[model samples]
Target: MSPIVVPSRLKLFGLVILILFLCFPYGGAAYSPHMASVVRISQIYSGGGNASSPYGCDFVELFNSSSVAV
Candidate 1:
């Protein structure tokens, strides 16, 4: 039988780094991609005079810049 051959210190360090990288994986960023927002608030109106009331209800509108649903 042949004697067991031990890996060098540098090789061991590299192997440990590789294992850690595979286990953790860039702070888990590789699993989720960065989100890009295409939808934005277009208009808002509050405290406007309509007929007689001094304070009015607020209005909010949403606009989609992209063609795809987001």
Candidate 2:
């Protein structure tokens, strides 16, 4: 059986991809604490201002998912 050979263009493309991946910044497991989303939209009431709804205005409720005070 003959040996399998790879093309030079494919090898060059693979090397370029590797270099680009190594040169650019990627987001990993380590992230800043301030970058976390502490507050989130807990509830959204779009049925407001209707006849069956109790509230007369549409509102969005926000809740803090973290333990820190806002």
Candidate 3:
């Protein structure tokens, strides 16, 4: 067999894609004025606590920022 060779244009395109992926933000932002899902997981508590622990249990709290009912 022989070593594979990549075209210069293809390499440049790959570099551009990598730069874009690194420079720009991935996934949705934390807060948005015009967001679809208003409900968010405000707090998360996991694992059972020890001698002086509050609540003493795991719980996931959700908060609704929007006024409309979900």
Candidate 4:
């Protein structure tokens, strides 16, 4: 018996569909207005006491653009 082979285009289309299915939820989640309000802040503090605080002491500020709290 001869081995069967699949076409590359069909394989690629299948892969794209699979990826879209897996990512659909994540993509939908990202579109939420709540996500737009979410903010990520980072600060680095020097170990030494003498080190001057950056920005008058490292801090993080989260702004809620939306009325709802996340």
lDDT of 2: 0.84
Q: In order, what is each prediction's RMSD in angstroms? A: 12.6, 7.9, 7.9, 6.8
Model 4, position 60, has a per-residue lDDT of: 49
Comparison by TM-score, 3 against 4, better one: 3
- Considering only N, C-alpha and C atoms within 3 Å, which residue pairs clash in candidate 3? none
Error of 2 at 58 (Å): 1.1
Candidate 2 lowest-lDDT run of ten: 27-36
Report the Cα lDDT for residue 30, model 3.
67
TM-score of each: 0.35, 0.43, 0.40, 0.35
**Per-model tally of clashing residue pairs:** 0, 0, 0, 0
**For each candidate, what is the lDDT?**
0.73, 0.84, 0.80, 0.64
Compared with the true structure, what per-residue lDDT tens digits does model 1 show for residues 1-70? 9998777997899999999999987676443232255667899776566766566666788888878776
Candidate 2 lDDT by residue in tens digits, 37-64: 8878889998889999999999999988
User: Positional deviation of 29 in candidate 1, in angstroms?
Assistant: 14
RMSD of 1: 12.6
Please state the error at residue 29 of candidate 3 in Å: 26
The list of candidate 1 runs beyond 4 A from truth reads 1-36, 48-56
Which parts of model 3 have CA positions greater than 4 angstroms off? Answer: 1-36
- The 10-residue segment with the lowest total lDDT in model 4: 41-50
Error of 4 at 58 (Å): 40
Best candidate per lDDT, number?
2
Residue 7 shift from truth in candidate 3, angstroms:
57
